[model samples]
Target: MLETTMPALASLEAFGNVTDLLVRRAADAPDHVAFDVPADDPASWRPVTTAAFLGDVRALAKGMMGAGLVAGDRVAIMAPTRYEWAVADLATWFAGGVVVPVYDSSSASQVDAIVHDAGVRLAIAGSRAHADLLTRALVGTDAIGTWAMRGVDGIRSLDDLTGRGTHVTDAELETRRTLAGHHDPATIVYTSGTTGEPKGAVLTHSNFLGQVLNIAAAYREVVTPTGNTIIFLPLAHVLARGLQLICIASGMRIAHLSEPSRVVPALSVLRPTFLVVVPRVLQKIQAAAADKAARMRLGPVWERAVSTAVARGRLAEKQDAGRRSRAPRGLRVRGAVFDALFYSRLRAIMGGRVDYILSGGATLDGALSLFFRGIGVPVIEGYGLTETTAPLTGNLPGRIVSGTVGLPLPGSTVRISPEGEVLARGVGVFAGYRDPRHDAEAFVDGFFRTGDLGRIDDGGRLILEGRMKDVIVTSNGKTVVPARWEGAVEASPLVQHAVMVGEGKPYLSALLILDPAESAAWAASHGSTFATGSPGEVRAIDEPRLRAHLQPTVDAANALVARSEQVRRFTLVLADLDDHELVTPTLKIKRREVLHRAADTIDTLYRGAAS
Candidate 1:
């Protein structure tokens, strides 16, 4: 039976506005560390107390109001994950304006599209490069009125505005705070537009606050007043922003790291208990660990023994925790030895305090999810979209399964339509996009249509099938789901990404991008000679021998699919799907864009131009 009801919890009546929420927390925990900014130049870290954090937020709010940002005005912020990003986001809310976030990695065109679409009057860019990109994006257009945070030749700086403005009186700030209520639009988040032009999802303060309430209730057992989180995911994404609000509501300390590569080192230093990450990050970590294990050169027997022991240990741990049915004493001992030898080092690298790694943004590979679980790190996969305030369903502690995106969070409702598309409703749902036409198609019977095909299993787990838009119809009238095929292809060690084609064609085809390092290592090991070439050339090697190596994986994928959906032909591509242009920032493949760009190659593959 599906579990749709949640256990009763405390009512959410503390504050009505985001600013009020922050202020109340600050007053209650004035001396507690609210945020930590770790510097890369040295081993030093800068900490912000709740009082100081609120002080900065108030100052920025006053500064924004002084700069003529009135209620309902939109202020766009483009920055990496940092303290200023959070401060600016809250300040924008406190100033009674909507915050528009642009990912730091977004190109000039993307920035321009968001600013123009959201009708941003002011933009706060983080670095000189970001400011430059904004300038380039605004060139030949009058869409943006001003830029701040990072100084440009003519635009004002956030520091300058805050310094020049008079302190906002408490009463005045209070009035503005009250104006920023639940129903008022708080943010305009742009979807990553993998399919087409990005649409701004207009989310109100109520929508975000509802998500915060759901998250707090979902993790009430684990979340503490002193819990610390390492924030590295881009704040532009709703997932990160929603998590940040949860931390604020629960009074968790947030450590902001400037660089992505420094995440492991920062974790070692901070010893944070919680982390939020995408699937790609986990995939890379697993790959690195496997590479290290391979270098140990254990014989087949030894490797088999170790793997068996590790599996037994995991089963034993599950049984002891009462999560599994049973385990033998001898198997438990073998598992313990394997954990001491291999898993312990991995845990230490994660600072040994990480109790949960929240995986979201995209579907995580099931094998990779199980691998982390086997290592004693519980990875809880969740599912959400920008339009739904980030999380609609997530795995609660002790109830997580590898292949599913758990049950709906408290107060959220997810239903599978007769046609199998996922429909969701609750306070967490956004108040529609800014455009009426888009909003009209996004909802039906008051429930938000997620545009993804999925099923609510008997156990209440949400099993995602694939995007409705990504389904391909073969010439033989058989329906093919590309995502399932892509997932299978990517399971191969040789493949990094795959896009299945052949919609309305005779047979299925695929554009495959091989994993460069793995392919290179394989080539070297086999003593196969290739032209000394660029990374692209190395990745695009068509040595018949290389194809022979990948055939087994291709055959396996073919065996898993219907005969009509089987891949009849495939061409290895030389270039990756560029995140900046082809894929969404969340790293989801933009099938239409990729196929359009590689139209000729896809056609050639269908025509059997190259065998």
Candidate 2:
């Protein structure tokens, strides 16, 4: 059994609770810009100083207290990513309430499960759309009072919630803020479980404080006030929320946008030093750049530039690993030329000064990781879940390995069990699930069973293979980790999801889901007519040209693994996953459920196989 632990840089013994981090910031640098709220002009954003932000939090916290919010009450924050969401989250903590974040995409049924499970007393919604959903979810449950970020037919807005506490005292709010100790439960974040209903992971003030303090210490250069980031991911996701806290701890200028579409305009305006990204977004940007290059008749130059970037990234990784000393001189010159001609523009697209782009939520494509590194912005990939306050392991700025998620975060221990399951224990680990029944299967001894299959590389980085349950064992007893090949194939823009099959069968095969937009782009590039519809209803699946296009992708994925583990055959489904439909709120596929639904298709794939 291989185990790795990164020592903690600091402890939270001096700090009473999570809210103290904000108070300290307010006291130290009261005028420093802490948050940038969108101004009336869509492109313009209004800066909120540390003092002003704290004042808002204090006011709202007092209002909640006046409105009968008692210590340890669970307040469900149901909303998209926005400024008010952050305010509500901090206010909830300040008011001695446990925040229960509900994804904007969550269905009413899902919301009902979480609300009842957490025994939520107050709910906050971002908009009328969310308010309506919250209203529906609250039906038949313990009657919970609801407030909206935007006022609705009869629902009071967050501003109204703030004004409700004219009688509440400042000292009372301070008392509530300091009430929770390090070990006290601060939030009950539900896991977006692929199988059963979501399980609420009870995270404490220490769970967050431990992560924030150590992470801010670990990346001191990047987490400083001069460094800043924007949050476009739903605050409901533990990763985004954890990042929000990290920024708060460091006094890093932070901003929020509800959707990915709104991120572009703010990028140039904010020029963030770092970014929060998902694998899908990385793939799209790469694909769009490639598509634009082709339209501009610079495809050859673009392709070569990409190759150079990958090569540069490869050499850098080797140097970091204490392998080769430096890049060949000729290669360096070529890379510089390409950087000037092509990569520089690509860097400019990300606001020209992004030091690193942090990625989580899913396994990023190794190829994409390398390409991005080659350009300038190294995708500092990390691995963790809601159970482990955002990151268990992450790559340091200069010590990145493209294909692997970096070393264990400070104060975290990552151990590969005898059965090859990844188990973790640390300051960041949550205080188990709200329901004790679920804890039995989740924790082994003291460590949380991550349910992921991975190995620690010689470089001490964590390279995730796939879910333990998702690993395929063929009839000949050859084991295969699907994500290795699937991620490679899905790196292609034309492919949205790649599900490796052949459990208890001869060899590995796959069910590839096509991205409609990417498929249309492919058709335009190929001079073929693209008919748009659902996979079963679309004629594109039967196109020989499309299959011919996918063949290289499968071949590339095959080359990554052994012959037995390679995808021998496959079929494409011209459909994509909808958030909370096929993909989880964290942006992971429901592999078991997807495969179960396609049982007939699997039979068809292996029907003519040789015994």
How well is each residue in 195-252 modelled by candidate 2, as lDDT tens digits?
Answer: 5567889999999999999999898867889888999988999889889988877889
Each model's total of backbone clashes: 1, 0
- Each candidate's TM vs. the true structure? 0.91, 0.95
Candidate 2 wrongly placed segments (more than 4 Å):
140-144, 319-326, 524-540
Candidate 2 clashes: the total is 0
Off by over 4 Å in 1: 1-13, 136-155, 299-324, 492-494, 515-541, 576-579, 608-611
Which residue pairs in candidate 2 collide? none
Error of 1 at 237 (Å): 0.3
lDDT of 2: 0.85
RMSD of 1: 3.4
Compare the candidates by TM-score and give the number of the best one: 2
In terms of lDDT, the best-performing candidate is 2
Per-residue lDDT of candidate 1, residues 244-294 (tens digit): 888886888898765867888877888888888887677777656666777
Q: How accurate locally, in lDDT, is each candidate?
A: 0.76, 0.85
